[model samples]
Target: MSGRKAELVEQVARIRDLDLRLLDRVSREALTLDRNWMVEYARWQSGNWQTMSLYNDSGDPSDVAIRDCEARETTVLEHMPATRELLRSFGLKYMWVRIARLPANTFLWEHSDYRDLADLERHRLHIPLHTNRSATLTLGGARVHLGYGSLWRLVPTNRHGACNLSGPDRLHIIMDCYADDTFRDLTSNLTLDDNDIQWLPEATDGEISAHLDEAVALGKLGYHQAAEHSLLKLFYQYSMPEGMGYDLVIRAYEMMGEHARAEQWRLEKKVKLCLA
Candidate 1:
């Protein structure tokens, strides 16, 4: 098995314990839902809009998507720190949650964590949360039952999809992991240096993946201009001009509460050559 794969299993086990603890502090009624993000994003694509009601089919042994829960409405990503901290008992960090509802006959489209990070790895952990009894969880092409207090891991990079068969509401609380001191020591303090230019994954559906790959290369080569240009070319509709939006990136990183890392990138500019 790959080192990343092993890391995933270990993290998942730790998170499961945390999940059990979280159920005690949380109430099935406490889970809240909102759709601001969904409506706004969907409106950008098309003017049609719908306010979705949050449902709780998670209690059902068998759940269905459309008939049980309406997915078109925006789902909220609530910050549950106590639940997040519980994962730390086993040494985990970085957490987020999304309460997903799939009415009967509804299917979650294929997706992965790859789009979430520029520095994605296959070893991260995922904790599936289903508080509803009728809710049935499926992953990696299989059906797995997770009771009210049960939690499970999902490696998104692998070919995976999900379905809810219980005619009720369900919530999927997923979290990701990174290598801690143990992993760093095992890797002998390895690092990922930059490159001059990296080609996009040809089959990436002209997605952000290619541009991100190029951006990393440009940053490594200290070619901020070219990198920004490529990003502009790829994300043409973005607010700032291409190859000149490091400030925007800095702001976003700041919003995500990653000031140190953002500052580190700014320091990378120190080595860059400036024109007279």
Candidate 2:
């Protein structure tokens, strides 16, 4: 990592933990509201996952689409006084804010956001309201178990995903804020120690083969999209070389006798990775 990038990682890792009681309060407040969860299918996410917007540029509660960072207005904050107060305490310029929920035994496929031209320079912060040991955020080959009552800065530029494996519903209040002097001040003193990092193990050949087999079976059942998603998910499940998951997708398409489609994915992979 470059010096600046390494500094950011350390700063984010050193973010001060929030109070547990405040997190519990926010959780209770969130639970009291009627659920208005929506999924971003275009992102190729899977399982029972959804998000509720609390703040956005439109100030429309129903608008949960993640968009370019901008000055935002509160949507559901009137109903979530505690949450509003909590955010106000930070005194940072906020952009989009939302509560994301991932039910038990669900997985969010690996993906990156804020990579497009429309995306503005900003940082994503997370406050875990409800989570268990099994809920993990995987990024840069490290699996992070962010405990409750703690604030974490997610690296939006990196390939990352989340999973709630055999756990209760996992919920997080995510806030997008523009980087500014105040942001720098808040993170300047924070430093992530070595113990804070946990590296993921490389997948065994048997494990990779078994997953590919499952993907193939899904394709045979005529669920081509599911099969593709299954193959794409391997990027998160294993410590494979860059673009290996994309290569597997092409292979899966070929296995299904879709030569044309395989070639299409081969090109798409390049575009997706900006290699084209």
Candidate 3:
């Protein structure tokens, strides 16, 4: 296995069957708040997905930009007393805390987080408040249905995506915490077992052809970026040959008569995936 794959396997861990009563309460309170939940990170995301920041740098609920982390609470946190107490009980330094909601038929495109940072001293954790069987997280070529009442540590540096094919709004309390001795001790007993890993089947040639046809149709409809995102999402959804997604994106641009853009995506694929 590559170093990156090994890191992902080692970093992602789950502590199942935690008491999530506080998180449930917080999710209800979050729905009542009129705070803005728009996410600005990726334009490809559907509007059905929303995010509410509880803890951030300036304590501004509208500010969703990821920056130097802080522990200040936004206005949304005022009504979440139980959540506050629960987080404090961890006895670890906190950074950013947010609630992400994904309604039925919504999906987050495949992407990695915190790549711009030089030092990765913080770890991202997820506590599922509400989810369904159809809601799934695809990471490191494995599809996982994270059950409710569990704490999961996600490897933010790895490529990952999420989808809620059918749901009553999948909600999760996501936290970024400083990795300290306390955090290490908390996860000391947790081990990555075979049961925790569920590999997605490889995409058949027919499926790949159908995806390409859909991409072509999307481009004809002038949704070029969405078309490209769809192709890139295949990389996370199924096991494919290296650089296949990038090549498809380049082809999509070429078909649109955008040679410069096509070449740009080709080079981007090389740099991002470290393809020689």
Candidate 4:
């Protein structure tokens, strides 16, 4: 067995916390950035998830077309000296870098990334600047709070999602890089503590039925979007069979006599979740 597999069991786990730490200066500089520069980008996100690009192909802060490119620092990074210094210290081949913000009651729906990128050895890293206990990521049957001070490695190919359940927006510097010796060395000390993980409890049949009924009620009241969001949020709230949230949405639509909408969601489920 390889060294990483011997330590982690799975070579490509959903998320891992590295022993590496980000400089306090960098975190402070990141927090000093004005929020007005942030632009809302609609990707797989379901709610108020915004981003300000630091590095990309076009140098446009709003142009968030993530792909393998010779990324250059955008004008937005020009004012963030500490952040720029930190990135230079890493010396890794970066594909894209951005400052991501997830406000209260926001969510990034369960989905894998990098599906459209060319097949290569790439990884995603996150450094939290401002966050709260309510900000968490869920994947592989567990929820994680990507706490401050540590650099986190996330395998974007795994089906995962994130949410900030309540007040106080969350901020993190997100980096996508191609694997190299420096990148390997940075993750060599990857470790996770039991306290960092919150295993989700499986939803009971009764609970599932109750949730479905609530969604149906909202749908009948002309709050179809809210109803759909309620069902989709189940993935973060409970550990059930894979794709159960999407199934609940389809079932709720069917119960409301919206067969066309139900079928549309069925196709959406396949595409969004990348179901085979």
Candidate 5:
């Protein structure tokens, strides 16, 4: 890692709250706009987690894979003037920007980002538009909610996952910005409140076995994906070593006589978590 990245990693650790002014106008406008969320990046998530790009490489909202490039505003931004203005106010070099929605019971499985991008300095920012307490981001053995009224910075290179356990959709404007002098200055100060963090404890062996049995039961009843997701959701609930949830999923598949799927998940775990 570069010196700048090393400093940033030390500052953020995993995730931190930023002391930026809130823009309620943008949040309100986001709720009223026509959201044409596209389902992409199936490998990183389970259930109804989707994205609609505002700024992307091709200026196409449907092109949602996050890549390193000079991003341009898509047609979706045309309907979101407040959001557009807010983006401009940041005065940072944006790589990609999108409106991501994670609906009820959705899960973004444990993974790291920027794994395939060039060795460049980039970071992610999140502004909550609409959300519920049940919606939380899990990383570093802690669950945190990036509540509205402030910007949240996440070092996407860390192993992490997210979930919305209950009803109602969780919406946020996510920005991937390349680091510059202005960006560094903007994030010179960050705060992580104890109240915002729920540190998870290590899952007991019995608890782990019970979850696996439940997942296996679900798989036997023809809810294979749900079964896998049930095990995957454990990452958000209790602390485990990296990729343990995926291992449980593989075990579930093996018990269900789906050896092919078991092997596939073994590979998927490595790929999604960037274990290789």
Candidate 6:
């Protein structure tokens, strides 16, 4: 498991399939509306959480960016084809989207997505629309420096923060994705939302299994780093005495030029502990 764990670390550095240009094409125009809505929502609610969220960002200089969820109505999320594709590939469900406007020389305080304390797949995703080479996000112990035309996502699963050292006002988009029951029973949760959407929680094997499947898919898609990171965050539930659960980690190791380490994990026995 330790060797596998080492492999997992390397996997996270190599994933780059998320097309920033494609996302930029959609978000450049779409950002105005989303930013406006967030501003308006912040003004009206002040402290109250809005749709698919817990609170609106006030663009406050003193405020550090955070994720928010709605009051009640939507507890579980339904998915569209495109969103489902992301969920299947990432092994998490989308709920609310968040954006933060950070001033220069500012950074968010470090924090982790508390297991079971938050919801399932409970983490944050960030994308920069406008920022210079100085914008960066520090995840786990590694600081991922962001440049134009890059896509990066991380679980609040570990402690993380952001730094805006550049001159431009850092514009970042955050989408919250959760893990839930029905979502876990199958590969992808394809139902569309007729009303409100709920974030899923990771409580049962169904949810955990779905996440593992998603991790595998992500690894296969060459988002090896993202997949391995997901697996590591889910360490408590996914790890079994059988141990081959770290197959993605092995792949990640090989990708990072750790063939010997990868071979070590490959020699371990594979085990899946079904909690029933």
Q: TM-score winner between 4 and 6, please give it.
A: 4
> Total backbone clashes of model 6?
13
RMSD of each: 17.1, 3.4, 3.7, 3.4, 4.0, 18.3
lDDT of 4 by residue, 71-187 (tens): 999887777777888888789889999888898998888877786778899989888878998888887777788887777888877778899998488988899999999998888
Which ranking of candidates, highest lDDT first?
5, 4, 2, 3, 6, 1
Q: For residue 95, give model 3's deviation from the true position in Å.
A: 1.9
Model 5 clashing residue pairs (backbone): none
The per-model lDDT (C-alpha) reads: 0.36, 0.73, 0.73, 0.80, 0.82, 0.43
Clashes of 5: 0
Task: Write down the worst ten-residue block by lDDT for model 3.
Answer: 189-198
Superposed by TM-score, candidate 3 places the C-alpha of residue 268 at a distance from the truth, in angstroms, of 6.6
Give TM per candidate. 0.38, 0.84, 0.82, 0.89, 0.90, 0.40
Better of 4 and 6 by lDDT: 4
lDDT of 2 by residue, 143-186 (tens): 66777767777766566677887878888888888888888777
Give the number of the best model, judged by lDDT. 5
Stretches of candidate 4 off by over 4 Å are 1-22, 35-43
* TM-score ranking, high to low: 5, 4, 2, 3, 6, 1
> What does the lDDT read for residue 178 in candidate 5?
92
Look at candidate 3 and tell me the lDDT of residue 177.
Answer: 85
Clashing residue pairs, candidate 4?
none
Error of 4 at 220 (Å): 0.7
> What ranges in model 1 sit over 4 Å off?
1-15, 18-22, 33-91, 95-99, 122-129, 132-141, 181-276
- Give the residue spans of candidate 6 off by over 4 A: 1-15, 19-21, 30-92, 114-119, 180-276
